[model samples]
Target: MAAGIMLFEQKGFSETSIQDIVDMLGVTKGTFYYYFKSKEELLMDIHLRYIEALLENQKRIIEDSTKTIKEKVFEIVYMLIHNIEKQGRQARIFFREMKHLNEDHLKKIVEKRDLFRYNLQLLIEEGMRNGEFRDDLPPSIATLTVLGAANWSYQWFQPDGKLSDFEVAKHMVSILLEGIEKK
Candidate 1:
């Protein structure tokens, strides 16, 4: 899986071959076949593991009672940005190569993805109810805006950049909650 991820991240899904994965690991073709039916299956497993981890983390943050909804939002954004360093390849592959997945695989992934989005929208609705976020923004749109901004960070996030993930997350949360207009 590690080899597959690295190769996928470096060379992309369509470009990387099963032989390349086995070559990286010094393993036989049969060894790779033993665990995965094909490269697409391996990619599916990798994507599933990544999204599952994210959902679990997101749910955990949502369940924490001590933090305000705003704080939870910060944490969720922070988690996504922070994961760039922790799970860079998995994320890049998940976002970049999703179109390659077959119908069955895509459907399953889409279901999980939609569930994540719905939960996020619910969180925004919760914020609106609690007056932590503006009620007039429409929870669904607000949720999509927040998620789109945060999730798009995968395209540009850098572990070695001037700002750390924490700094980026804080800045994003500020703009998201407070807006660019000066007081």
Candidate 2:
């Protein structure tokens, strides 16, 4: 599965063949088939694992009673960056190769993605209720602003870069909660 994910990340998903995975693992076709019915199934497994992990982490952050909503939001962003640093390869494959999954698989992935969005929105709503965030702005817009900035970090953020994940999260939180342009 790791080998398949690596291949999918390096090479485009459409370019990767089931034979490539079996050959890379030095296993027989029967062995590969025993584990995964098809390459699509393998990709789905990767997506499922990634989403489940992220959801678990988010749940932990949300359920932490000690933290303020502001703190929880920052923690969520930091967790995202931290997880990406820990699983850079899998994250790459999970995000980039998702398009290769068929319609049914894509639908399920979309549902998971929506769950993430909904969580973000809930955080925004909580912040608004608590007067920690700008209540004038719609919750959806704030949620998208926060989520978009955090999610797009995967495109440019380098784990080994000068700034740590928490640092990046701080920057994002500043821009998101504090706004970019001066008051």
Candidate 3:
């Protein structure tokens, strides 16, 4: 699966063959087949692993009673950016190669993705209700804005760059909360 993620990121999903993956891992075709009936199935597995880890992390963040809603929002954004740093190739393949999945697999992935987004939306709505966030903006739009900013970091965020993942996430959360306008 690591080989598949690397190859898919480099050569694209359509260009990556089962043979290429097996060759990279120095494994037999039978080994690949034993785990996944098709390359699409392998892709599906990768998608499931990525999103499920996220959902689980998010569950922990939301359920933590010690944190304020603002803190939870920052932690969620940081979690996403940190995951991108740790699993850069898999994250790339997840966002870029999802179209290769079949209808049923695509539906499953979309449902999980929506659930994540919806959960974040609910969090933002909670903040509004509790007076942590302003009630003027729609929670759904606020959720998307936060997601869009964090999700796009995979394109350019470098773990070795000046800002650590936590710093970047902090800056991002600050911008979202404070905006760029002059005080």
In order of lDDT, best first, we have: 3, 1, 2
lDDT of 3: 0.96
Worst 10 residues of 1 by lDDT: 131-140
Alpha carbon lDDT of each predicted model: 0.92, 0.87, 0.96
- lDDT string for model 2 (2-119, tens) is 8888898888688999889889989888998999889899999999999989998899999999999999999988888888888887888877888888899999988998898899
Write down the TM-score of every candidate: 0.97, 0.94, 0.98
Between candidates 2 and 3, the one scoring higher on TM-score is: 3
Candidate 3 TM-score over all chains jointly: 0.98
Q: Please give the lDDT score for candidate 1.
A: 0.92
Off by over 4 Å in 1: none
Consecutive 10-residue window with the lowest summed lDDT within model 2:
145-154
Better of 1 and 2 by TM-score: 1
Off by over 4 Å in 2: none
Q: What is the lDDT of residue 5 in candidate 2?
A: 82
Q: What TM-score does structure 1 among the candidates reach?
A: 0.97
Candidate with the greatest lDDT versus the true structure: 3
